[model samples]
Target chain A: MQRLIVWSLAGLILVPAAWAGGDKKNGNDKVFKIEGTLAKDDPADKLRKNPHKVHEYKMKAGANYVIDMITKNAQELDPYLRLEDSAGKNLAEDDDGGGFPNARIIFKAPKDDTYRIIATAFKGVGDYTLTVRVASEAQSILEQLKESLGTKQKELFKQFPAAKTEEARQKITDRFYELTADSLLPLSEFAQKYADDPAAKEAKNMVRNNLRQLEQSDSPGVGKVLRTLREKGPKEMHGQVSLALSQNLRSQYERSYQRKDKDAGKLLKEIEDLLKHVGENHADLASQVKDVQFTLKNLTVGRPAMEIEAEDLDTKTFKLSDYRGKVVVIDFWGHW
Target chain B: MYPHERSLVKRLENSPFALIGVNSDQDREKLKKTLEDEKITWRSFWNGPKGTGGPISAAWHVQSWPTIYVLDGDGVIRYRNVRGEAMDRAVDELLKELEAKKK
Candidate 1:
């Protein structure tokens, strides 16, 4: 035969280009660029040292990658990113996106093999610069802008309860802040032009955490589109959008001090002017706004009950002023 | 919450009400097997194993998670975060204002 049919069509095109050149010479899907330095003896540095720098790759299935880390000591680390896979589940995670304290993860490989990437430090640590790329057309424009922003957020939540009026709910809250800034300003200009693509900083921090949960709605046009995205958003998400607008103005000052709502001291001076724009380097949100100003001055509702000793399961010690005359009802609870 | 405070502690077992619990569960045999499988006849307390800064939800500034208050018989706090049946109508209007201040 003609030389064994040209050597069986060159052994079926050299066996898939010698199995894709032996997975590009054994570096599986390649493109890593790791660099580390967390410290305090690595392994999740005990107590509060926060350290967890792991990395591994392989991936392939449908390709696309993007995992970035970066960190030029943004006020002592603070980065955090997680991926996991080889059975350890969790597929993606990030904190402070690549702003403030860097971390990113723009995945795709739903199958093919190994994954794991950890890199931690939500407080402080040091050096970093992870990076991984592959990025197929910025992961098909972030899966077509996350399937057209989940079909325009389910058609703006079905036109938000038929906008019954307040000028048709402020024109459906200005068309939900113009469909969340036309679906996150083109994924924040494709993550500032692939700023070392951690899936375009995870699709621009998932469109700024879904526009900070629609600016924690209490509606007036989502509080005037969160006061115009706190005067034009993205300064590394102004301290997580002013700590979610000071926890939605301390849950509307505890629902206007539990319905005695004559705007309870104007919602406690608008929660002390949103905890003075939450600054004092957020000492745990200024000790949770000084424990909500000591539970609005000693646990509200006509204050007074503040004692509580605790210890019963037969281990004695009681008190809450030992149920004085009686009509107590404390609760507090938890068995799980 | 423990079946509406175990049926308002058996409908205020003979009045002058009390129901104080606190608990935080750092596993004292799983809070004594959930206060003996939830029969929980009042008297609780515990709040340790560092939950909410232990020592009684950091001395009363408990910022939510089952925080329920309601004191009255001169103790003071009059209904903090009422619940089910508005916490049985604020303990039947503070046990009818401590039975009209004991006559």
Candidate 2:
């Protein structure tokens, strides 16, 4: 049994590498194709019995790529795709994001590194044709913004620790906001033009989410800049900016509770006031705000670890509280 | 991370320390095979087939992968989100407190 298992696993690992090598050898290939069928004993099949396959590609930093996995027969197979960095951090995952029963992901590579594209079936296993296409214009613009914003953010953070006076810190904060708004203007314009493109939409959403998170900074100038962006910047992003501001306020309220800040009550009241302005169209954001409120009621540090009962590989039941006499470390993880 | 965790589990095997895992893998057979292949003797709780949305992770509100939590002997969460040497130091201190209490 042990020998059989080792041989089977070795074959599984080697076959993909051999296929990838064959693709590279076929001249300068712009699009690479992977053809595979998931079987009952295949690793992908074992991962939920849906057949999951992993392909690796050497991707350049700042390059935008669209990955598509379409099954030959839509009636028999539905494809799911996930892109992960070298460290197994998931960049994106999609099911039915393309034409029905197919998968598509538009991603801008964060760094020049090897990335894994994981293809799987939602139900039954079948053959899939996976292709990677480069989007040149999108890639070029994304790369520029990524480089400039990264440098500016790094320079600002470096100065933040050394600034001794409130005025000096405020100046730094204002510059950081100015850099953000200036850099985001072009991308926002691109998104406005290419409203239907997933890559553009995703890029726009990322900037909005990041700006929302930045609203948590203690610098007073940060809020002023955010208000300026909302009032005077692109009209298309106004609703998004308002929602982000609400999220930022919600985050601040949560932090106050965690830090036992004296202004926790005031922050909570502010969050309530901000929520009123968050339009009804943002049901998702409203639900998230409620979730945060729920989290505030529970899940505080120093509280007793929540009681849990789960089965081990041996199918034996165990309770978390059963190990009360021993110090415990709980690791939440997935093999994939 | 797994290698360091394995060694830590072995080092504290005979002590009043337990390393419980809440695994989010969907397949039981694969997990069993991985455990045997990796020579992992520590017991791990199977979170369920839904991966991240598994009952345990959902109940605990785990926002990220490999979220580690350290609990004192009394089951109160003392430290969290610490890994590597920081995790080692925190666990060592907690064990000493447990030992001192026993005395």
Candidate 3:
């Protein structure tokens, strides 16, 4: 009995706790070290609604810091970094709309406080190796930091001007043809850096937040893609979109058939057909709709999976059974 | 909080925002540390009054960590699902009544 309890405890909580525990630096710098699978990929791992991977760390005020994320599992990761105090008011955040598994991030920590270095990723990547280094105020800025941010920020600023109409927005958005959303941060960095100055921080945050939202947006890029296919895409773009989500992503968009697209009637029909054909088709676009449905359906945090309960480190049991009658939103996620 | 909530939090400086923190998550210490680090002295919790005595899990049918619900003084649930910045907007709108009551 003792051995069983020990082993179970280790598997469920101890091991992951060990990995979450940070490695202390002797004097100045702080690094957040996560070394193993925190949760053995839950069946709902891919179904993660909010993909913002948050990391928390403590750094000396006014000290230079570097944060790096080197991933091993999900390769399609585009990561954005941020620093926040406990109050949830963002002290510093990068709208870089970016990535790096082995990226070397550099910044200065505010004086005399414990701040969290949040690591946010886009795309579906695997395991990760994140390194954050803190340097004395005396250390010089790295080459990347010293490089001219002004020119780059201006270029991105001009290129990413607010879209007047959804159509106009679509035109610029096409340039972001990423298969899984990892490398979209250059603009994000520009926005945050110039937030307080002449540049519009609200607009910048909008874009960064939009990208994050789009990653979790269940509306699927399908509707927009469908519109483009007929007007700008291959002659038979309709059939292709149908095949992509149903065949590859493992999902179906049935209600879409009721909706009319000036371009692809047959394609919409095909999508419905695919869903009907497979009682439970897990379409790729299902990811996009997950957030939509999660929000629209009003799901809460504890009620979705009431039956599955895991034991914590302390000798106590948690049963989802207790929260059955209340609204529950299920969330499977990680943070620093 | 998301954009909508950002607006609401701004309105509630004098009003109370029932910002309860549930830390019976995979990272309790981190959550506690987060509040302290951010200097957010908002009233938070570790799974209700069980207070580390046990894992007071989805008892209220919570599906997310940092999940929040607003119940009026009358013992009725005024709002159910709230989160991110939108959640801020939600509780803020409700707290507006408190401000009005004062007037």
TM-scores of the models, in the order given: 0.27, 0.47, 0.27
Isolated chain A: TM-score per model? 0.28, 0.42, 0.30
Q: For residues A1-336, write the lDDT of model 2, one tens digit per residue.
A: 999999999999866765653445321125666776655555753333466888888777766777899998887778888888888888888888777879988787879878888888776777889988666575556656776787988989999999997679868876776576555556677677666766587678767866765654534445555666678667766656665555455555544654668997896666556555553555656765565445433443445788888788788998988999999988887777
Estimate, for each residue in B19-101, the C-alpha lDDT of model 3 and write its tens digit.
Answer: 33344535555555655555544333344334333354434434454445544322233444445654555455545654565
After the best TM-score superposition of candidate 1, give how far the Cα of residue B54 lies from its true spot, in angstroms.
27
Task: Tell how far residue A86 is off in model 2, in angstroms.
Answer: 35
CA lDDT, candidate 3, residue A309: 54
Chain B of candidate 2 achieves a TM-score of 0.95
Q: Deviation in angstroms for A120 in model 3?
A: 31
Fraction of the reference Cα-Cα interface contacts (below 8 Å) that each candidate reproduces: 0.90, 0.90, 0.01
Off by over 4 Å in 2: A1-206, A212-284, A299-304, B14-16, B61-63, B73-79, B93-103
lDDT of 1 by residue, B1-103 (tens): 7887888888779898888878777766666766789778788788777766787777786766887878888787776667788788888888997999899
DockQ of each: 0.34, 0.47, 0.03
Model 2: lDDT equals: 0.73
The reply for model 1, stretches above 4 Å from the true place, is: A1-228, A234-247, A251-263, A268-336, B1-17, B20-103
- Cα RMSDs, all models: 19.1, 17.5, 22.7
Better of 2 and 3 by TM-score: 2
